[model samples]
Target: MMSINFEQLKERSLVIRKRYHELERIHHESEWTVEEDALAFLTDAGLVGRHVMSQQGRWPKENTEEELKHKIGESIWWLTILAERMDINIGEATESFLTKTEKLFEK
Candidate 1:
């Protein structure tokens, strides 16, 4: 599979978020306009979803049998934005974390 640069991936994530927001509005749930508000909503929703999934041992009924592709896109968007805003490369962070964690477990 081909990998995408951060900029391209971020652009695609914005479109994905827009599509979901439209769908949510059609179903009478959306109440935000700016990306900032939407990003906050996504953050809350993600944490809530994680808790629910952990309790149920699986995804919600909406994505029980398949990947929540759009939600995944939303997560990627937020993570990328957060990393850029903080001036950190997430890949590098992950590498460093894994390296340190591995050393701790190397007994």
Candidate 2:
């Protein structure tokens, strides 16, 4: 099986944000309040969820694994963009969440 590294993926988020910022109609990080960016990120995440359901045949629209993969990647990009605008360290936040969840279920 191919191994995936979250740290490497996290680093690419910055590059994605930079490229996306260059696209027309995309807002600069400075132009948005964290709340606004957070909302936008949430919207993208919801679309990703819909795509996932569609891939499972639980939602409407003719979806394929490719579509699902694209949506997931797009959602991650939005997430990183929001994090950047908010001055957040995505890697640290991810680690914190993992640690918190692991401790929560510790017996």
- The prediction achieving the highest lDDT against the true structure is 2
lDDT of 1 by residue, 14-43 (tens): 676678679878887773455665477577
* Model 1 poorest 10 in a row by lDDT: 60-69
Best by TM-score: 2
* Candidate 2 local lDDT, 12-91, one digit each (tens): 77676556556623554354556766787788788888888888889877946787787787777777667666777777
Question: Model 2 segments beyond 4 Å from truth?
Answer: 1-7, 25-36
**Local accuracy by lDDT, each model:** 0.64, 0.72
Give per-candidate clash totals: 0, 0
**RMSD to the hidden true structure, all candidates:** 6.4, 3.4
